[model samples]
Target: MNQFKKYPNFLIGFDRFFYRKEHKSTRRRILSIIVLILIALLVIYGILVATNVNRYAFLSLFTRGLRDQKQQQDFITNIGIFTLAGLSFGFAMQVKIFNIGISGQMLAGASFAFIITHYLAKTGFAPAVGGQLITIILSMFVAAFVSVLTGLFKIYLKINEVVSAILLNW
Candidate 1:
C-alpha cells in the first residue's frame, strides 16, 4: 500500500484525511480522524509558539499548577463549579431544555450570599459556621429560582429558551 500523501486543498486542509474511499474500514476512518485532530492541534500550538504569547498557558499547567498551592486549589474549585454546571446542563438536556443561564443563576446565588452575610455582619450577629450553612442553602434556592424564570418565560410567554437565557445572562 502506497503512503497516502497529497497537497490538500487550502480551504479544507484535512481533505487528505479521506473518509470516503474504496477501503471501507472502520480503523482507517478512525485513524484519519485522529490524524486530522492532531494536525489541527499542531497548527494551534505552532501559532501560539510562533507568536510568543503566553505559551505556557496551554502547555505547562500540569507542573506549574501543582507547584503552586493557591493555583491548585483554584483549579480544583473551577473543576467543581464546571462539573456542577455541566451536570445541570445535562439534566436540562434530558427535559429538552437548554439551560444557558446557569452562570447567571450562580451569580444570583452569589449575590444572595453576599447580601445575607453583609446584613448579618451589620446586625452584629456574625454566626460563622451557621451563617455559611444558611447562606449556602438559601443561595441554592435563589439560583434555582433564577433558573425557573427561563421555564416560566417558555411556558407563559412562549419565548425561546436561548433568548430567555441570553436575556437572563445579562
Candidate 2:
C-alpha cells in the first residue's frame, strides 16, 4: 500500500481512512468520523496560519488561558454558571417547554446583582467575599423571578413561550 502523501486534497486520505476495510463495523465508522473531523480541523487551522501569521497567537492564547490562575478561575466560574443554566434548560426541555430567554434572564440577573452590589458598597458595606456571595444569591433570585414571569406569560396570557421569550429578549 502506498503512503498517502497528497498535500492539497486531504479528503483522499480521509476516504482511505474510512474505506480501508471491506466491512465497516459501527466502531470503525465512528472512529473514521472522528478522525476525519480532526483532520478537517487541522486543515482549517493550517489555512488560518498560512493566511496570517498572527493567527498562530490563538495557540498561545489557549496555552495562556490554561496556565494563568485568574483565567482558570474565570473559566471555572463560567462553566459553573453555564452548567446551572444548562440544567435549567434541560429541565424545561424535559417538560416539552422551550425557553429561549435563558441568556436574557441571565443578563437581567447580572444587572440586578450589579445594581444591588453597587448600592451596598456605596452604603459602606464591605466589598469582599461576603459582598460577592450576596451578589450571587441576589442575582440567582432575580434570574428565577425573570424565568417565573416568563412562565406566567405562557400560562395566563396564553402566549407561546418561544414568542414571549423572543419578545422579552428583545
Candidate 3:
C-alpha cells in the first residue's frame, strides 16, 4: 500500500460538495469555490506525483521566467499587448456590441506607430521620451478611426462587423 496510492479525499470531497446538498447551498457558494480550488490543487498534485519527471515539468513552467531575463521581458511585452486588446474587446462586449474587427484596429494602430517612428528617425527629430508618447497617441487615433469605420459599416451597409473586420484585416 503506497502512501500516495490511496487518496480519495480529492474526489470524494468534490462529490460531496456538489451532491451533498443539491437543493440548499446558495449561501455556501463562496466557501464552496474556495474548497473546490483547494481540492483541485490537491488533485493536480496527486496526479503529478506519479513521476518525478511530471513534478519537474510542472515546476519548470513557473520558474523559467524568473531564471531568464530576456524570456521574462518578451513574456511581459506579449502579455501586455494581449491585455490591452482584451480590455478593448471586453468593453465592447459589455455594451452588447460585437466588434470583431479589433485585430484590424490593432494592425492599423501598429502601422501608424511604425510610420511615426520611422519619420521621427529620418528627420532626426527625437522627443524627450524617444517619441514613444507621440507614437502611442497617433496609434490611438488610428485605432479610433478604424473603429469608427467599423461602426459605419454596421450602420450604413448593414454589414456584420465580423465581415467588415475580416475585409479590413486583410
lDDT of each: 0.83, 0.82, 0.83
TM-score of 2: 0.61
List candidate 2 segments past 4 Å from native: 1-64, 127-135
* Residue-wise C-alpha lDDT for candidate 3, range 1-170, written one tens digit per residue: 86544877876866776657766477677678787788887777777886545677667766777667898898899889999999999999999988888888999999998888788789998777746886898899999999998889899999898888888888
Candidate 2 lDDT tens digits, 57-138: 7577556666778989987898898997899899989998888899889988989987987787799876788868978888
Clashes of 2: 0
**TM-score-superior candidate, 2 or 3:** 3
lDDT of 1 by residue, 51-166 (tens): 88787775774566566789889888988999998998999899988788989998999999999988888999888787789889999999999889988999999999889988
TM-score of each: 0.70, 0.61, 0.63
> Can you tell me which runs of candidate 3 are displaced by over 4 Å?
1-66
Could you tell me how far off, in angstroms, the CA of residue 64 lies in candidate 2 after the best superposition? Answer: 4.2
